[model samples]
Target: RPLLKTALLGREIVYIASIDSTNNETKKLAAAGCVEGTILLTEEQHGGRGRLSRGWFSPFGKGIWLSVVLRPRFLPQEAPKCTLMTAVAVVKAIRKVTGIPCGIKWPNDILYQGKKLVGILTEMNAEMDAINHVVIGIGINVNIASEELPPDLAALATSLQIETGQPVSRRELLTVVLYELEQAYALVNTQGFDPILEQWRQLSVTLGQKVDVIGLNNRFSGVAVDIDRDGALLVDTPAGQERVIAGDVSIRPA
Candidate 1:
């Protein structure tokens, strides 16, 4: 147990034993002009959220539930790319620190052995053409046992301890993840999305795989080919073709 080392980036840090949600706390601080790299972490989240309005199950002291506030100088249109950036950072950090192979499912779920180990939620307060700030919420299943998961999620979700056959230090993993996030964020802000997008493709497990994307109007099946600079998934569908900006992507392995 070493203490977590975050990017710091000139922002203050806040930690709590329990909270409604780290994202909610970070959003409030950001609205009050919290500096970049300000992080809110809690051991438990009473009302944790997932993508698509789903509620996440986070018990006390069993996971890494945290949110980061970032003020990237980019237009609102360029926001989705930040999700991709965070996904890449998480995957890289897991591999770097633990030597465990991990991959990204579209949008922002990190998977290992076809089970989700991480979930990311990104929110932005935008007006006109600019974004005031983005709150990136990251929930990681760190030290839980397989038997600890709820009956419904036991089949689809997994923890790092279950995959590694031993408990991992939450602080260590968080440090690495924050460092990687800062690096990727800087590259995207200074260089562009091309480099990060390329790296994202290399670490992605969904590309070239047949996937079912649950769209607003209807569901469609296609082969995921690539992701655009705007972070939209390009799919080659049988019924002509299409691009998906947002959806629940399910991979159908060959």
Candidate 2:
């Protein structure tokens, strides 16, 4: 059956049994000028990585490990919207597939009760004004069992089966996610990023919370008040308000 009902996404799916990283593979294809919405999926990713180069645990056929290639007309400065939009798409898919309400943590991590459920990595290659290609890497913990998770990640990660008390279909979840992504992707690139930003705020777990952000050369603790127009995190700190473009955010003890 054709699981995808979208005009753009999954138009050409490169499925592999195993790979080092779907994002890496997709990036190569993108560099060679793969069409927009070319999806590179793998049953298992041996060297999957998340934001900040953190290892993503993808074992065998238990999860959805994939990356989509997009050649959007967005300027380099507007690249942050891709991560925000992708997070919303995954959140919508999780709600429909498992009926579990998951929240997005700042830039791109999807979590439920502080446990990570999905991670989105949006990487782009571009000139100063225009983007060459954007590879959105999405890793969803779908059918991995509770006890089967690695000891290091057991406390901090979760799967759909663990939340729903039954096995959820990865194919179905992936289909819905891709469909939602295509919609959000088009909307953000066409209409504007504000609409998707509003949806991101609604499902945001980082907002209205005391948090700490670690950037490349700065770190600060503050209250996450809101997001800016370009999807930067606006934090209210003791010094003043800080606009964080890319950082590692953790909820601080209140």
Candidate 3:
């Protein structure tokens, strides 16, 4: 891990040729008292998962599939800020490495030219007021061609290669990602969430747009106005302003 410039993250990495899910493996290690900043990286994931229990497509040697173990000293309610931090880090890394300027869709999806380029799923083991560990799972489609993606995902997903019209080095991209994440994590600890939130806003594509949010039992259409301190999306509806903490957000045509 010498190539990584981060002080804490990626210091101890476990690399495997294939696994069911990096997040699952990282959770197992976290429960066994693995140190914070430990990373679980796999070349292939057979049973990868996304938010809302969706399956992630991870073919062998086509993308970056990994999970990071973090032990942040923050309350359970502040966990969503970590997801925002991750989005900023990923966006910064992609822009720096591949020159593909990307934006973040609320919560944790990275997009390029309105197509998804990266997905992040953050899970935490915590109580009401305390946190034991947090696992940040990230998947970035790097070299996969557009035609190689599944038919269902062809219009919804994209890879770095497709966006930039060139191949990207996964190793270099991962290193830069880790470094950027470390920097953002440090900022959250030292400066609090305001600075990180500002960066998130600048890189966000969801704010100030009409959106439709689908929750478990309810759906609403409104204009996304702002993100609260707790990282909740504030949607301005016809009735009033609504705060959405968790849901699927889709930007609608204005």
- Number of the predicted model whose lDDT against the real structure is largest: 3
TM-score of each: 0.94, 0.96, 0.97
The Cα error of candidate 2 at residue 48, in Å, is 0.5
Q: Which candidate would rank higher by TM-score, 1 or 2? A: 2
Q: Candidate 1, residues 1-254: lDDT per residue as tens digits?
A: 13545455325679889998888889999999988888888999999998767898888888989899988878997888879999999999999877889899887899998899999999899888899999999999998898899999998999888998998988788888888998898898788889999999999988988887775567778889998889988889877767788535434554
**Residue-wise C-alpha lDDT for candidate 2, range 1-254, written one tens digit per residue:** 27688989988889999999999989999999889989998999989998778899999999999899988888888888888999999999999888899999988799999999998899999977899999999999999998899899999999999999899988898889998999998888788888998999999998998987766666679899999988888899999998877645434424
Return the candidate ranking by TM-score, descending: 3, 2, 1
> Scored by Cα lDDT, where does model 2 land?
0.88
The Cα error of candidate 3 at residue 170, in Å, is: 0.5
Measured on C-alpha atoms, candidate 3 has an lDDT of 0.90
Clashing pairs in 2: none
Instruction: Score candidate 1 by lDDT.
Output: 0.86
Consecutive 10-residue window with the lowest summed lDDT within model 2 = 245-254
Q: Is candidate 2 or candidate 3 better by TM-score?
A: 3
Better of 1 and 3 by TM-score: 3
